[model samples]
Target: MRVSSSIDSIYQNNVTLAQDLKSFVDTHIISNKYEKWHYISRIKSLESFALKLERGGISSSSTSLDDFFACTIVVENSTQIDKAKDLVNKFCDIKCKRPNSNNFTHKQSSSFEFDDLRLYVTIKDDVTVPNEQIKKIVFEIQIKTFLFHAWTIAVHDLTYKSDEINWGKQRVAYQIRAVLEQAECAIADILNLSKLPQLDKNNKETKALNKILNVFKNHFNKIDLPSDLVRLCSNTSLLLNQFEVKENQLDAFLKAETSAGRGTKMLGLSPYQIVLLGIFYQCEDKLLSVLMGEIKLSIKIVITRELLDFIQPDIRKFILDNSIPGIIVLA
Candidate 1:
């Protein structure tokens, strides 16, 4: 009866953790704006827990099971895996992390394990919660790419976990997995296609936009950027022929600025704003000239508003106080 009561309590705790995990994920991961992703969660059923206990080969204690509650975060591609890992690290206390074979070299064409990244974490003390349930329990977070996740959902259980596990069915499952693996490889290598250069050869604007997006992707570790903002920035960059702002240069500038004690002042700016600021610093004279002379009044106003939105509050105050001559005359 005591063991049964303990199991019941554990099940309730797992349920609470699952709920809190969703809230935590919604707060951190959902807000990041990945291109494609979804999450699924489940608390182990009471019967499953009992079966594990009766099996008696592993730790029978409920508290010892890391996967009492589990959540799977499936992303469109492997690139977002790092971003997910970063968020997990920031928000939770990682007890153990199992790195998956993302760069797997499959020697056997017929075998596929489709191992995915798994993290066992307890909620960090810094993250606020309604109850202490999260801190007490360790839960699992599995990160899987879309292709692999699809196979697992559609075919894995029917073949691998089926009551009648025939060799033929298992072989078919492996064959399907191999195909999915090839598809993932092709998707990863699509950027390196030989014809892509020829196709985009004349599209300098597209190239500029891509570069800007890449910058955002690397710095923010996000799969997608705001298209309108990116397009606007890309156009401005192309206008001045100054889209060649290297990432290292931007990083150095930010480091120097932060060191000089403007970190607090710059705290209000978003990631997009920071990138724009770096661009502004790189081509200030050209940008100022283009804004002041050539651009239309409406364009000038829009550009000015975006730049002003990006700049530090104190800098905006400075511009206001000085009247900044042509800077905000139309704005």
Candidate 2:
């Protein structure tokens, strides 16, 4: 009974340490905005601890629980994985690093695979706890893309934590892993294409574009559209600035359109469609053509005929004169 009590105490202390480490890591990652979505897990049961002990043997002085605590950070894509690794290396002391790989049965491929980092942190001496009691607390951190995480979960479910060598299932798992790798690459490419180039927050043009977006947000009172507007504005601003479309010109154009009874109709259109109309009214044929090609087909349809009815007469004439293909028109 005494020995069991001691083991329980050790497990409890380790759980506490794991929670502390998770809090610290979460604070750092969440502050960055890009690395906010992450997961943390600890070995709470003695049975799991005993399994670790049996597999690896007792190596730590402050119980084997230290080796069993871990956290995983799943970012959006491969580039974010690199960003996360850099962030972890900046604050935490890395014990070992396992970069991304494709092999299914590779030693690093199982859990900490694909651009993952393992960090070792030590509790500070300034804490009130006695040095001898909680001196050797260490935990693991794993980082990967969301796609890689999903693949790992699928593979783990199939394998079921067994050590038996099942060749047929192993081959199937390897093939599935390979396909997932390709899917990850394809997703990363699509994300890259869809993402607007980062805008300089301090730039005058960017500030102007943001003001236009704010006007839409304030008028609409919706949350989802603002971000989509920002992306569209960023892309349009890049093209429009080349023609010297100053902030005041955009403001004047917006006011004229609003006075002409366009603003009320804009409330019905998705943010992207509004941006498209704004660009069509303000930009030349060449730029408008380029933008038309860039916009996704699904978003292009979001601007219904009733919404297009709100466009300034000259702009409507320009569209009719140019006869832009795929530009929806009402009968």
Candidate 3:
């Protein structure tokens, strides 16, 4: 589809601005010790903010620039946001001075354009690095959660149809947009949960899930993780059953079979893999239901059982420290 020129500029600006901000933040603060990608590469969650509205340009009827939204990044912790604003102003003002060296005696100033919209990056405190490193290293960054990472996704290609010509309900489109907004809001909330300084202050499930996903994303391609993972889950399953949790045994049975037998081996699930598997599956489920706080102890029970069948001796060792013998599994 032909995009509007104004909207096109906005789209271009959004990507450029985000990268520039990331670059500016990294160079000024992160120090030479850290690679630039290390800070931003881990941002798998940033792509969530992109909005995929059709007619991605201004028409005669269009009124505001928001019509072509690329995405939103929110910082839940107010201190971090304020610091970022300060840094932007500080850096830009200095840049605007051209050849002039503004010093302690004279503070520089410049006209910077950006509306600070508060979202969630989940940082606990508004602490900055040493005065010298303030420019490169930012405490945290929060981005809107979108369905997919790239230019489009199933939600957009299927939902927004201009060429094929399909219309079910006008409200469905609005509902999709609403859900997208909520996803962005929840991402802020999750970021807050991620950066909690004290364990007692943060959302346990969100933190736990994020960590597991990190492990999976980092290692899944390199090695297999289901066999031992299944074995570990066995212990958790038995423990959950002891607590009288009624779980879906069928799911448990399926996972147990899948991981323990030739299927997982054929797929090349590696050694000591239960913890990662259990954590990934459980966390994915939890994150999927972040809007709902209730944990699914029952499904966890099944997944745990599934893990048990695949446990290798080395993999079995991992559960000794993490397992709760009598508590119900929170899958």
Candidate 4:
């Protein structure tokens, strides 16, 4: 039988590891009631599954000769890293497979495994979350802030400066480091801001951000649309605007991609530009659906059946009543 890249969930250790990690994160690190954290293992597992076909087996894929790579779970904000600790445990089983002519060579194929996993624990006065359950030697959980993510983007761009290892990235590396420094500051700012007595309009950044939103909100309401979705939509718009997106029209946003845990995203179109005004983007339907087309949906349907299987019946019913068409699948 072909050694499967598939995560052997049937193994008791894997299950125990996942549950233990989940419990640790939910209890210790994600203590902030308002903060969000998630499990990003299945993503890693699935990608390794595909890659295992090319390598002789999972054995060829790692130093341990038995384990496979998994996916990254995202940290939604900048303050979660404050809760991250070096509390992870590891388990190694060397009875694994190895790579060969039959293995896949394409590096960008999978979103399942990342260099590490990040667990964002909320930084609040009320509770201290846990971080003890992680047990895979190959998997790492990071506690990063939003700023950390932005810095990562810049650092990634810097890594490709030249073929030379060190000197090639000299000038750009400074700017990359700047962005990382900013991430540290941003993380600190959010952490401090969370402790504020209350949010106020007089705040400089808050005011500036709110003013930006007001302009967009007024623009959105002129067309008669729901305002609640504006924050997410506006977040998308502000990012484009920063890039000097001269073309405000959604048609200009021909690029839409979705990662395993990232859900779905598009450039060029506001949620307003698509769903509110009625536009559609189409893609090739396959195991991976990101094949590009012109007919784009204003809003991509993010609710997949896999996600629905995890919800409580009562919550699922609530989502059915409130969620949009094609966004979530019904039970």
The C-alpha RMSD in Å for every predicted model, in order, reads: 11.7, 12.2, 19.0, 21.1
Task: Give me the runs in candidate 1 sitting further than 4 Å from their true place.
Answer: 1-28, 31-35, 56-62, 100-110, 195-331
Q: Which stretches of candidate 4 lie over 4 Å from their true place?
A: 1-71, 76-78, 82-137, 157-170, 190-331
Once superposed on the true structure, which residue ranges of model 2 sit more than 4 Å away at CA? 1-13, 26-36, 63-66, 99-117, 121-136, 162-165, 188-226, 229-331
| lDDT for predicted candidate 2 compared with the true structure | 0.57
User: How good is model 4 by TM-score?
Assistant: 0.27
Candidate 3 wrong stretches, greater than 4 Å: 1-22, 25-142, 145-152, 157-161, 164-170, 175-331
For 163-184, candidate 4 gives per-residue lDDT tens digits of: 4567546555555655565566
Identify the leading candidate in terms of lDDT: 1
Worst 10 residues of 3 by lDDT: 36-45
Q: TM-score for every candidate vs. truth?
A: 0.52, 0.49, 0.22, 0.27
**lDDT, ranked from best to worst:** 1, 2, 4, 3
Comparing 1 and 2 on lDDT, the stronger one: 1
Clashes of each: 0, 1, 33, 40
**lDDT for every model?**
0.62, 0.57, 0.37, 0.39
Q: Model 3: per-residue lDDT, tens digit, 133-181? A: 2232232332212231221233456545444655563345545555554
